[model samples]
Target: MNAFTRQLPKLMLALTALQLSAPALAQVKAPADSSNQVVVPQVDRRDVRLPRFPSNDFEAGLFGGAFSTQNFGASAVGGLRVGYHITEDWFVEAALGRTTVSDEAFTRVLPGGIFTPGNEKLQYANLSAAVNLLPGEVFFGRDNAKPSSVFLIGGVGTTKFNGQRQQGFNLGVGMKVFLRDWAAVRIDMRDHIFSVDLLGKRETTHNLELSTGVSFFF
Candidate 1:
């Protein structure tokens, strides 16, 4: 063997040793003390505020409509209502209404008619309970949207006509659109049923009323 050939074996041993120690040298170069450690930042939190809304629980309004008295034809009627909301979907109301009914049709057949003078004032008072079945929004234009609800109502009260008071039952459906946080417009269709004794016979009568009104909330 020549001198270069004899030194080649030592060179191979040195290279193998260097390769085995390289990984250990790389691990030592990495930081292990607190000064070079990774930091987790701590940040202060802020409070988030919630939005506020209107809280209206009572309302009063006036309404006018056509009242169709079973056999007395239709007449103009006006009413006032005061209501209290029991929940988001339920309410109670007290309503008082008045109308003048003409017995002209009966007069044409019978001279005396149901009422002596052919016309008599009719008044009613009702305590009603209402439930909101459909709650939605009413849009007037691209930029206007109002909250609205469709409700069903029923009640028991008394009707006064011909100098007599009769127990009456009323059922209705209505829609209300909020014009503002404190004001709303409403439309209602209701049927009032009662037993009346006239013409020497006792029979049940159905009176229908359709009305539109405005109300204010507090």
Candidate 2:
């Protein structure tokens, strides 16, 4: 019985040592071949490359927002766009917009000579190419499992106002917040520039527009 009691401690010590070495044993037996093995690394979901959403090649949408000029007053603007994604990160779009200048805006820009404020309109049609600045996911709630993207858009277009047509170019930044894979909310800020033949001299007018609406994927 004395021998057995002494043996018990040694046996217990042996079991304790085995328990400690079990992790080291596991380290030594790590699979040498990666073939036919699945290894997952910790990663932020946004960093993960999500598969391309099927049927996302084409998109069409409408947007409405405020438009204004540096020298002119603010006006209400509405527009629509049809876009085709050339790749995961690139797309081309055609957009059209019409802004109705307020009577106050028209009078504000007119020189103090004799003038009457009448209905005025500013309209534009543009073809732009945009690149995904951030192609997927919003930092906010991903309600309904939808992802959104922010992009930069720039292109050339024509603007007509006061019975005169001017050719110009524009630069814009926008965000598309997806409510569904096939639908999203789009918001944009764009700057327009063109040379207008006011009198005999051509002057450049700087116009800025901000708009938001929704779109559907085809």
Candidate 3:
């Protein structure tokens, strides 16, 4: 054979080796493409905040005004109240009130008055549920304003007067204005109905009470 024939087989073997390694070289280099590579981005994050609300569900207060005993005329009355808010529209309260009713008017016309001298003290206690009927704002000036609400309330209680204990029912309407988030000013009008033995007769009487006071919430 000539030299060209002798080199042909070696050239064929080198070509076969290159063909076998082609796939391995392509697999190593294919991942270098930008589309095939996974790129991680560096990022900075910010904090997020939310709003807050207030919850003041319990309240206590003191009040003073006039109590009009059915026949004894109106007298100065003072009271205190403790309450719990059931919801934004409803609440329950327990109250105690005291006043003195004079029998001076009856004494002038009769020898013996309806009540004795020491028995003129009148006191009452009640547990009541109230509903907010009108909730609004009260403005004092251009820059001052207060939150206010009008409510209807009624409940059963006990009234003691002239050394007698009697079951009573009371109904009232009230308005309250918030002087601060923790304090408020309130005005109320109530009528207490009860039975009492006066001048040898058992009579059902309606005693009207009007009061204003300040309250605190917790």
Give the per-residue lDDT digits (tens) of candidate 2, residues 68-135.
85555788899899999999899999999998765554445556421245556788999999999886
lDDT of 1 by residue, 96-184 (tens): 99999998888678878777777999999999999999999999989999999999999999999888799989999999999998999
Error of 2 at 183 (Å): 0.3
Which pairs clash inside model 2? Answer: none
Off by over 4 Å in 3: 1-54
lDDT agreement with native, every candidate: 0.93, 0.83, 0.93
C-alpha TM-score for every candidate: 0.74, 0.67, 0.76
Q: Give the per-residue Cα lDDT of candidate 2 at 23.
A: 95
| Candidate 3, residue 133: lDDT | 97
